[model samples]
Target chain A: MQLRFLRVIFICLMSVAGMVSAAADLEINTPAITALKNSMQQRHNQLAPYYVSGAVGLTRDGQIVLRDANAVPLPQRQAVNALVGAENQDRSALYREIARANQHPEWESEIRSTFAGRWIEKAQPGWWVQDSQGGWKKK
Target chain B: MTKKSCIALAALLLAACVTINIYFPAAAAEKAADKIIDEVWQLKDGEAAGGKGDTGSTDDRPATKPGATK
Candidate 1:
């Protein structure tokens, strides 16, 4: 009987959390999520110059892409490509982490879609952003 | 009105609301995304990293966020 009661309590607690997660913003703050955010935040610095120069652009799928490969000199192109790869890996992890943190792993796609739109919406004026239709435009 | 009729009315109302919520919630997701961006980017000064400081190598977590909309 006691075990049954505890199970009921656990279910109720989870339902409450689910409701809260559904209604609110994605502020998980788990160590993994925080680390991912901080990592992205730090990497944003390295990527900032490229963004300003129109070399890299934010995609509609919450990842960055090389918008103008020729923008970077041939010698530095490899380094920029490496940075874009690393940023994308961290971005994928951040989306997955947010979904997992909310206990709804399936929400990852929606979260990523949300972030994609948000990233473009929040992009700087000169920064390139991909539209929902896969078209790139300066924001 | 009779209690039975009142209950029926409430049921209809609830069904309508629930259907709206179950319709994929694109608006809600966008609203939530905006709030997250505000917090994460911490857009200060003008835009994109404290106006004057696009300088890399610093934590860019924003200060506070507004409430989420449904």
Candidate 2:
């Protein structure tokens, strides 16, 4: 009876070891995600001028994701209008710019929240950013 | 102690360790941003140095040459 008990204990220990090993081998592909996140951030910075002039609009998979007009000057309203008009006509150029900036494949969903988080972190006083839930907040 | 009680105790201990939450580090995020931005700056520099030819390809003519008569 003692021998049988020892065998069962040994089997349970071996199963537990297997579970631990499996968990250890579970590698999260975080680097790719991080690279993509960083690329989006770089794109945001590259487009900062447009954003400040209320000229930048971003969408993911045909859904308007972010519409920002935080730093637009009152005197440059015409410029803003012109840019918006161009964007409304066709934002393909803007999307292409972002995709190139990130070195990411076209048609990949741009995770706007990741970029938003980065922007919020770097925003100067009184600048505005949209949160993950699309709520506007001042930084 | 009963065998069932011993097994339950071991399970409880394992669950405690497994349930620990890893907090997100803000410093890590900042570090990541700095590194990425530095890489971007290098890319821009390379483009400036003509390592990547024709930066003008992406420029929208209307935006760049504002004084052009229509």
Report every candidate's CA lDDT.
Answer: 0.74, 0.42
Sliding window of 10 residues with minimal summed lDDT for model 2 chain A = A57-66
Name model 2 segments beyond 4 Å from true.
A1-31, A57-118, A125-127, A131-139, B2-4, B21-70
The CA lDDT at B57 in model 1 is 38
State, as a TM-score between 0 and 1, how close model 1 is to the true structure: 0.65
For model 1, report DockQ. 0.14
- Residue B56: error of model 1 in Å? 11
Interface root mean square deviation for model 2, in Å? Answer: 8.0
Write down the TM-score of every candidate: 0.65, 0.35
Where model 1 places Cα greater than 4 Å from the true spot, the runs are A1-22, B1-32, B39-42, B45-70
Candidate number achieving the greatest lDDT relative to the actual structure: 1
How good is the docking of model 2, by CAPRI class? incorrect
lDDT of 1 by residue, A1-139 (tens): 5555455555555655565456555446588976776677667778989999999999999999998998999999999999999999988888788778756678789889888978987898999998879998887
DockQ of each: 0.14, 0.07
- Judge candidate 2 at residue A35 and give its lDDT: 46
